[model samples]
Target chain A: MRIKELFINNFRNYKSLHIKPKENLNIFIGDNAQGKTNILEAICFLLQGRSFRTSHEKEIINFDSEQSKLKTELKAYNQNYSIDISLSRTKPKIIKINNSTTSKPELATNFGTIVFTPDQLSIIKGSPKERRRFLDLELASFYPQYKYYFVNYQKVLLQRNNLLKELKEKKQADTFDLLELWDNQLISYGAKILMARMEILKKLIPMAQQIHNQITSDKEKLTIRYRSSLNLNSNFREELIYDQFREVILKNRQQDYLKGQTTVGPHRDDLVFLINNKNITDFGSQGQQRTIILTLKFAIINLWSCELNDVPVLLLDDVFFELDSKRQKYIFDLLNKDVQVFITSTGMANTEKNLINIKKNAIFNVRSGLVCEEEL
Target chain B: MRIKELFINNFRNYKSLHIKPKENLNIFIGDNAQGKTNILEAICFLLQGRSFRTSHEKEIINFDSEQSKLKTELKAYNQNYSIDISLSRTKPKIIKINNSTTSKPELATNFGTIVFTPDQLSIIKGSPKERRRFLDLELASFYPQYKYYFVNYQKVLLQRNNLLKELKEKKQADTFDLLELWDNQLISYGAKILMARMEILKKLIPMAQQIHNQITSDKEKLTIRYRSSLNLNSNFREELIYDQFREVILKNRQQDYLKGQTTVGPHRDDLVFLINNKNITDFGSQGQQRTIILTLKFAIINLWSCELNDVPVLLLDDVFFELDSKRQKYIFDLLNKDVQVFITSTGMANTEKNLINIKKNAIFNVRSGLVCEEEL
Candidate 1:
């Protein structure tokens, strides 16, 4: 996949900007807060139908303007496509693919992006919530239906929790049957989500371990295990998982009734990282934690290409300079002809020496929302 | 403050290591997953009587050993002192200052250290929990009694919550009286904590704003506001704050009883960051968020020096390379003769050019749990 042209209007510091990016590498260089990262955020919003930085879509619109607009022209699977998205302060965001109205999952399935930002360092050291988010994002990118299942699961979970609260307050018998209905819906949706997650992890863990070993020169081994609230078995069919989910929900009803919240489900699942049979969060050094995250990125890139038969566009936001020369070289080695990468950096001098060997690349100077493409 | 010598035994991948650091700067260079960060963690543990990376002290012990030991010889206020700490698998950590048994707050008051790690980017983006932690750590470093107040506040809040649970379950008249007693204790401790936080914010906010302006070249203004659970007035005497806290507790008892938990206290307070009067967490770009955190760090360093009449040692863990040359220069400017600094990096070539102007600096090569001092 490649983003050949990007257009933005009234989007985060960018009043009106358009650029023709390189096929392989597009690097945006500027000082701090000079609108370099805003460009990437715009691309991410277009690809994912949401801004990675802020949950409030209205924040992406410029202060003086009432709405923000973004357009991306890309080639994926040897076919041309364009994604157009518009956001307003008081209205819902409108996403159009090839000039027709579309949904978020459709846009994501048509265009895949892998983004790495400094804030994402949480996936390594943060709470279980962060780890679950990382896994869900990865799953949603490749499997569009997973998003539907996830959304339904959350909706059912919310309704179920509210019903629980009502039952605790009113002690109504009819509410108990409604609880059973919501539970079945929750279990069905959750089982699909869990099965998809377990299947993806089955493929992702080994790839991450392999990359981690190569990155560490075979000095370390990385392991990622899914810590589900239910007792999961090796046989991970949807029906079996749904049965296990039902068993747990039945077992947890008394506790859930007391707490007035859904206590066990995919919502409570977590992923744990281990190195050499030790939990990295408690045992590994900071550098080790960083390397594990980096390794996961490589593994995701490889897995996406292997399963989809097309590469995902990579977005690197101020992370290239943070890597050492050896690890940077490993990343560069993976930037083959098929991978289109967009990188935002505060300065180019620190990484220019490493970019000398890349044949197809372009540099753009971003200053106060104005983007000017420069010749190499 | 300057650390003349640092020694570690059986700590995080290091069987034993010792180094004589320079008075101005000490840099440890290594590849990923090496022992560079461990050295800094050891220094932080010695200065603060706790590890900055992990809550589990036993994890610091090397896999082959049963305990970890650290010693630091330093000079502060033109006087020499040594801190010794030992952590065992099944026993509490022991702290000794100048060969006399000491406590954590006492050690922190005598030896102050400011640490910046990549994981701390969460201070700007993660959650209210991270922001409160940033404030509490800063307060505890300078004012030892703040730690005591914070500990007591947490203790009272927990007990108060337990009583609320009991009242919900049993509804005994005796339990209601006990809740009132706990509420009084909670308000007293909570007021001291809230007052201290407000006072510190009054001092720290302006300093952070000044530094943020300078770092951004006057392009942006920074504002920090304390968002306490209580509606506080500007007259921040402990007595007034305590009265307000008590009123709120009284007003919230009904809701607390229904929910079976304490509803309001310092434990629920939060800090909000604004760049140019807009909430940074909601509206700022990633670079803007990162720069705000960097600004807060420089502000804390300045505030500590101004209040204590002595500088604290600064520890940078894999964060230098993440900054551009201009922001890097801002950091270099703060490294005067009085401020001792320790930095860990993955490679020398990326930052070697920046280090050319510093005459009082030392570099060490760290590889696979071993460290060797190298001439700059």
Candidate 2:
């Protein structure tokens, strides 16, 4: 979807701001710490109901103000939509669509946005937790059922852990019955999650490979494999899962008692990245690793487009300046076709000229916290 | 930031997909599990060099393939920018900007984006670890310096914890000199982080209150108090911190040995949210708690905008459908202005008329890993 207009009041450095986006290309140029990124962030906030920057909603308010409001008008699928959010200092923030208040799930159903930020490189260099989060989020957004199952799985996981702790503390035998009940719930949800994740991976692998070939010029072949303690080769019925873990759980009872924690199940599952039949984490160069990540992202985009039937809005914040000319040109040539884009740069000079040549383009100069349109 | 064009190959569902976004608004609409959110996630992956949906890059590839690629051409800040990512089933994900390979930091500098999702609500409802993570991610994105400091702090924390573990195992005297050195590093980096957080919080409090007031119709006030065990009330100098923790560390030395972990410092700090002078976690309705989170998100958007001088992209995945109509309308009205927006919904019937009225909108239909543009 594309954003038609945005209004910010007491948000960041904009005491009161209003802007209309160009249909094809909108650019924000400013010096460091200017309000360039803020404009983009406001859009993201309006779409997602949270900031890409900080977790605390209070931070968005202007320094002297006790609240902030973000408003946006969007045109998608031959439709018009509005979103409003108000931030306060003494109570909870309120969100409304059109003019009605809503909950997160409902809000999610109404607005869907994707963002590209620099920190995403962590998917490669960071820990497994980060990677898992990526999968969970993507799945949650596309499949509401995933969200429900995921949330339920987590709840069960937490409750199970707590029960394990209690069982240990009380040194009780009867608690096994309670544990069984929780385990059944966990398996029901966990198995569903596991199946869904596996299915998604199955669907994503081939597409990722072709993109990897293009990015690497066929220099390398990459592979992704899901590794779970529970064998996927066998029947994954609830009874099977319980049977597999029963002995292990009983044997680890003493350890669980001592540690006050649960030690097995999907929580411990990991995804393995292999390059040329070897683990990339253990052997790949930094450059190679980065390329692998890039390919994966591209593959995701392709998959998303194919699955969703729409090209998502691209938000590029200061990323262009970091790439070499050849790669930059490839990207430019590709995006030159038909996509609405918003980009933030330290300065306009840092960008490529092809972008300026686009017919439908709007450029804005951002300083401190104010934005003004610039003539091409 | 707005997306101009997107191309994906073998990432998740699309073996090969290409689409151009509308200049102003684009919508990915489909039934659950159709990959609408995946499109947004792919964009986020390109910008961040990571996926917002999954943690593992390998998982992004189609299941039958070995790798994936995501390419996006962005008209940002009046410039053309391209980002390409490659993910392999057997290797690390790779990234390129404008076709030239680059590092994570370089990618981050070039592409900046902000995203908001339904999961963010957990920042308020979840444990303190989640909240701390929210803070860290924001700080790391806007201020690269904080990233270094955070890394260093983590290193020191790890080392100190290891030393504690070793001492306990060997039952040796405390390594006072080594401890002192680690403490110095920890205090230095921790102090900087705490200081920056405090400064940001100082600005966020007022804004959150005001927004909360508006959301609650002046029925409640929201407050965020940073509750640190580090004696933030006093001068946070290294000397003072050392003095304050000296006795406690010394006395707890043996106990720490038994526990095998460091028991004190900023790592143990918590962020407490208060509503109407009462702790929300301790006493607040589910709705109140949700509003607190919503307000916090808005506040974060404002804070990031003000601090970084750029508005980050908003990623809203199914949050709109979760709220009441009043709140939904508020968000819809807000979105009516200027911010570039990307939204995903099961259908348009639930959205505001204004959003439905825009003509320069791209709408896609997603189903079972297949996408088709809707005839407008």
Pick the lDDT winner. 1
lDDT of 1 at B230: 91
Candidate 2 yields a Cα-based lDDT of: 0.68
Summarize candidate 1's per-residue lDDT along A153-237 as a digit string, tens digits.
9999999999999898786634466788999999999999999999999889899988888766677778889998999998889
lDDT of 1 by residue, B324-356 (tens): 666666666666445788888876554545554
Over B73-124, each residue of candidate 2 has an lDDT whose tens digit, in order, gives: 8865556888888888777778898889898777876666666654465576
Candidate 2 off by > 4 Å:
A166-178, A234-260, A275-298, A337-339, A347-351, A355-357, A360-363, A373-376, B1-376
What's the TM-score of each model vs. the native? 0.89, 0.52
Ten contiguous residues with the weakest lDDT in model 1 chain A: A349-358
DockQ of 1: 0.49
Using Cα atoms, each model's DockQ against the true complex is 0.49, 0.02
Q: Give the Cα lDDT of each candidate.
A: 0.82, 0.68
Quick one: how many clashes does candidate 1 have? 0
